[model samples]
Target: MTALTTLGLGPLIPLGEALPPPEVAWRLALVGVGMGLHGGPTQALVLGAAPPGRAATAASTLQLSRPLGFALGPVPAAAVWGLAGQAHGVRAGIAFAATAAGPAVPLLTLRRQPSTTAG
Candidate 1:
């Protein structure tokens, strides 16, 4: 589900280019939906995979990373927007976002390996 949503988002966002305000709003809304759909499940998987006594540490690390990602994720897009000028900035930003999301799909879909520790 996470991989699917992430994959869909890459193309869906860029398709908003040159669209009217309402159309763009819908695309952004879908992006929000996609993020929301994956967020909880991803967090659960991260926490679940944590070693027995380290759940709190895992949770804290996850919490910290979320804000850090939110803050930094837009930097490249913003840089592109600034460099490309207003006429093309929006499209450039969208392209940057799509490009960034593309690689994440495979990572999201990767199978977890079995634990090797002696039981």
Candidate 2:
């Protein structure tokens, strides 16, 4: 959140738009806290659900996904920018990360779901 301040996200901030400043601030704070809570719990859940020696591998898989998200995020923007114009392309990129990646998260729930045993 602090990092976004310098990134020039004033456009993302709502001062006159439908969302009031208070609402936007609340959501922004939730997003920051949510990321922290999600990270460790997700890793632990994945590892806990894995069978036997696979626990380490499952955790590694989760770690690998971090870079995968980073790598994949720009592709949609590049594609959108190629097909569309500047602003649309940027929106497309953000949608790719916020929505496309959002759905992929449900797939991770499988790894988090309880199994017969935790190794």
Candidate 3:
């Protein structure tokens, strides 16, 4: 169930572009559920791996990277969007995003060493 829901977000842009307004509106209801299933696990993995009492701080740091990456990640794609068009831009953007995801994944997949208390 969760994996299916998570995977459904894979088609967000193309589905939105393909469907009529009514269908898009109806499918919009499923968007949150799908994203929650996908993103919740991701966020949990980030927060869960943080040290006690400092988890929130660390999570903030992790989330900060998100917006920072938005600026950093899509520069080339945005330039392409300006010069080329949305379709090419979006394709480039996705490829860039996937490349970014590749490096962070290994970092996040480290063995769960027990977190030491600061006290």
Error of 3 at 92 (Å): 6.3
Per-prediction TM-score to the true structure, in the order listed: 0.80, 0.53, 0.43
Whole-structure CA lDDT of model 3: 0.54
Q: List the global CA lDDT of all models.
A: 0.73, 0.54, 0.54
lDDT of 1: 0.73
Residue pairs in clash, model 1: none
Query: Candidate 1 lDDT, tens digit per residue, 1-111?
Result: 444444544555455346677766666666777777777877898887898899999989998997898799889988987898977787787788777877777787676
lDDT of 3 by residue, 66-111 (tens): 5685577557645654564654654444344334444544554576
> After TM-score superposition, what is the CA distance of residue 44 in candidate 2 from its true location, in Å?
1.4
For residue 116, model 1's alpha carbon misses the true position, in angstroms, by: 1.8
- Candidate 3 regions with alpha-carbon error over 4 angstroms: 1-38, 78-97, 103-110, 115-119
Model number with the top lDDT: 1
What is the Cα-based lDDT of residue 12 in candidate 3? 39
* Best candidate (score: TM-score): 1
Q: Tens-digit lDDT track for model 2 on 11-101?
A: 3332322546665666556555645556776676677678887887888888999679658756875676567664465444444445543
lDDT of 3 at 75: 74
Using TM-score as the yardstick, the better of models 1 and 2 is 1
